[model samples]
Every structure is written in C-alpha cells, then in structure tokens.
Target: SQQGEEDPQALSIQEGENATMNCSYKTSINNLQWYRQNSGRGLVHLILIRSNEREKHSGRLRVTLDTSKKSSSLLITASRAADTASYFCATDFKETSGSRLTFGEGTQLTVNP
Candidate 1:
C-alpha cells in the first residue's frame, strides 16, 4: 500500500482566479489521479495521469506528474465560487490490481465571490 500527502492544507481565492494544489507520495505508482469533493459529498474524479505520462488536462483542470520526484500537481483555471471544495490526490500502487487508491489528506479550497 502507498500513502500520499497534500500541501498547503487549505487555500482561499476569489472567483475567476486560478487555484493550484499539490500532492506528494511515498511509493512507486501505476497512476496518479485527482478528485474533488463538495462539502459532505462523495468524491468526483477530475483527472488521471499515468506513470509514463507527464501531464494531462481536462476542460478547466490541468494535472502534472513527476514520477522521479514522486509528486504531482493540479491546476484549476478560472476558478469559480462553485469550485469551493476539497481536492485530493490519489495513487494506485503497481503491486495491486489497481482497484483502490491511496488518498492524500486533501486541500480545502474556498472561492469567494
């Protein structure tokens, strides 16, 4: 099993501003993924980048991975107040069947209007 840690713990920004979050892991992984969670709700997958890939983008979301550094980052462009939520990074260990993800603590994002 692998573990992940998120930095800055929390973030605050105004609507239309961009938000960035980072994650670090302790072990080799098959892939890394990012997810968003509204308060008291289930997590929604945002993006995934494989160990062989460096970066990926989806709509207003961008994700970057550095397998060598065992770290990853997520960027949200033109963030909105509706973007206020918790962001998490997860790792899928190569040793496992990749059925589960080891999640980071999470970054609490607050977007003010």
Candidate 2:
C-alpha cells in the first residue's frame, strides 16, 4: 500500500520565489524524509524529520510535520532554475514493515530561467 504521497503533481516557479508542497500518509510511521531529484540527476536526500518533531529548517528549506493529521509540508525559499526538479516524500514504517524509505510519486517542480 502507498504510505506517503505529495499533493499537486507539478509546480512552476519564477527564478526567485518560494515553493511549497504537502505530503500525506496512510498509517503511523517512524520517520519521514524529503528528497529532490533533478531532471536527470539521482535523488538526493533533502531532509529527514521524525514524527515527534514539528518543524525543521536547512538553509532555505523549511519542513513542518503534523503527526495528528499524518501530514507534512516542505517549503523551498528563494527558488532558482536549478531548483527545477521532482520532489518526493518518503517514510520509514513501523517495526514490522522493515527499514525502507517508501517514496511518493513526487511533485514535478519547474523554475523558469
């Protein structure tokens, strides 16, 4: 079963702007991580914020989590054309599920040059 999925399949942005996306899950989880994949680049880990945490920030990226709602949000500040890529959210399930980062379909982001 799909554990986590991001909202809005795609997003287009200007050279210098902020973009936000949300992710929702189906069951209780151990932790959730966000990743970014360029058009032809490997998916790189962006952040990993646990269920117990509410929010986290790294550089221009801000992430928020709401365990009660089984949801999370990612905010990218000062967008650039290089930021154009697909973003995905993944989660580590409970003990019985094993340690696997199940990723979502992803949200395609376009930053116009």
Candidate 3:
C-alpha cells in the first residue's frame, strides 16, 4: 500500500546459495537503497543505486534498478548464516517540500548452514 513494498515477505536458503528480494514502488524515485538489519539490531546500509544506473555491486551484493517498471531487486551471492537478517528497500523521493525516504516491510532471510 505504501511507496516501497517488498515481495516474498520471507526467504529460506542454504549457506552457499543465493538470495534475492524484490521491491516495487508507486511513484518515481530519485534513487533506491537496500539495508540489512540483524535481529534486534539497527539497520545497516547495504547499497544505493541512482536512477540513471541500471546495476551496481558491492562485494557479494548486487543491486539493479529499473525506472520504467518502478522496481528494484537485491541479490546476495554465496549467502552465509551470518547473512541471515531482514532486508529492506528504501526509495528516495525529491519533492517540492524536500527529500523523502520510504522503507518497505522487508524480507526475512533465513540462511541454514
């Protein structure tokens, strides 16, 4: 119902496998960002991709943004048990008032060793 809403709500995977989470937004965004949060911990910024960029990478994490579809995706390669956390997608909107950031519910990723 909000600007940024993620799909699959939850994910289960092996330690060596990969995990992917998708987010869809309603309005145009200046940029999109992904964040990770361990249980009972504060969120950590994962990556950020501007509207002009199609894809970006940081270590084992890859992010892709599609402006036409108003969607973005995050892929974690060689996921580990330590990577088990909640991943959220945030959209940055530059409005007449100012910039606004909206976060999705997030996808709970459980990595089994």
Candidate 4:
C-alpha cells in the first residue's frame, strides 16, 4: 500500500530557479527518503531523513521532516535542466509490516533551459 502522497502533481520551472516538493504520509515512519528518477527509469537516492531527524541536507538538496504533521518537504537550489525528473518519497515501516518500501505517487518536475 502507498504511504506517501506528494503535493502538486507536477511542476515546471526555468533553469536556475529553485524547486520545492512536499510529501504527506499516513502513518509513523522510521525514515523518509527522497529519490530522483530520470525518464521513469531507475531511481537515485537523494537523501534520507530519519524520524529522529527534523532536517537534512545533501549538496543542493535540502529536506525537512515534521513528524507531528507527518509530512516532509524537499527543496532543490539552483535548479538546472538536468534536474528535471520525477521525485518520490519512500518509507519503510518494518516495525509494523515486513520489510517493504512504500512510495509516493511522485511529483514530476520540469526544468526548462
């Protein structure tokens, strides 16, 4: 079953502009991870923010988690055309269910050059 739901089904932006994506989840999570996919192919791990972590950053990506609200947000700074891709939030609830990862529908981001 899907656990995460991303806000704003799609986004379009010009190169150099920042892009922000939000995700909401239904239940408690151990860790929330972000990934980037190109052309609907393999996903590249962007970052993973644990339930104990309120925020984390990697390179140009910044992620914030609010367990109280059961939500998370990702921000990409200095967006480029190469950054155009689908972003997904995934969570593993091994504490409740067996080891299985549930993913969000994803947010398709378009960065125009």
Best by lDDT: 3
**Candidate 4 ranges with C-alpha deviation above 4 Å:** 95-97
Which regions of candidate 3 are displaced past 4 Å? Answer: none
* Backbone collision tally, model 3: 0
Q: How far is candidate 2 from the true structure (C-alpha RMSD, Å)?
A: 1.2
Which pairs of residues have clashing backbones in candidate 4? none
Candidate 4 lDDT by residue in tens digits, 37-58: 9994899989999999998999
Output the TM-score of candidate 4.
0.94
Candidate 2 C-alpha lDDT tens digits along 1-113? 85688988999989889999999998888899999998778999999999889999999999999999999999999998888999999988766656777899999999997
Of candidate 1, the 10-residue stretch with the lowest lDDT total is 93-102
Per-residue alpha-carbon lDDT of candidate 3 for residues 15-68, written as tens digits (9 for 90 to 100): 999999999998888899999999999999999999999999999999999999
Each prediction's TM-score against the native? 0.94, 0.94, 0.96, 0.94
Q: Is candidate 3 or candidate 4 better by lDDT?
A: 3
Instruction: Give the per-residue Cα lDDT of candidate 3 at 52.
Output: 96
- List the global CA lDDT of all models: 0.92, 0.91, 0.94, 0.92
lDDT of 4: 0.92
Error of 4 at 16 (Å): 0.7
Tens-place lDDT digits, model 1, residues 8-112: 799999999999999999888889999999998999999999999999999999999999999999999999999999999999866545467889999999999
**Cα deviation of 113, candidate 2, in Å:** 2.2
Alpha carbon deviation, residue 16, candidate 2 (Å): 1.3
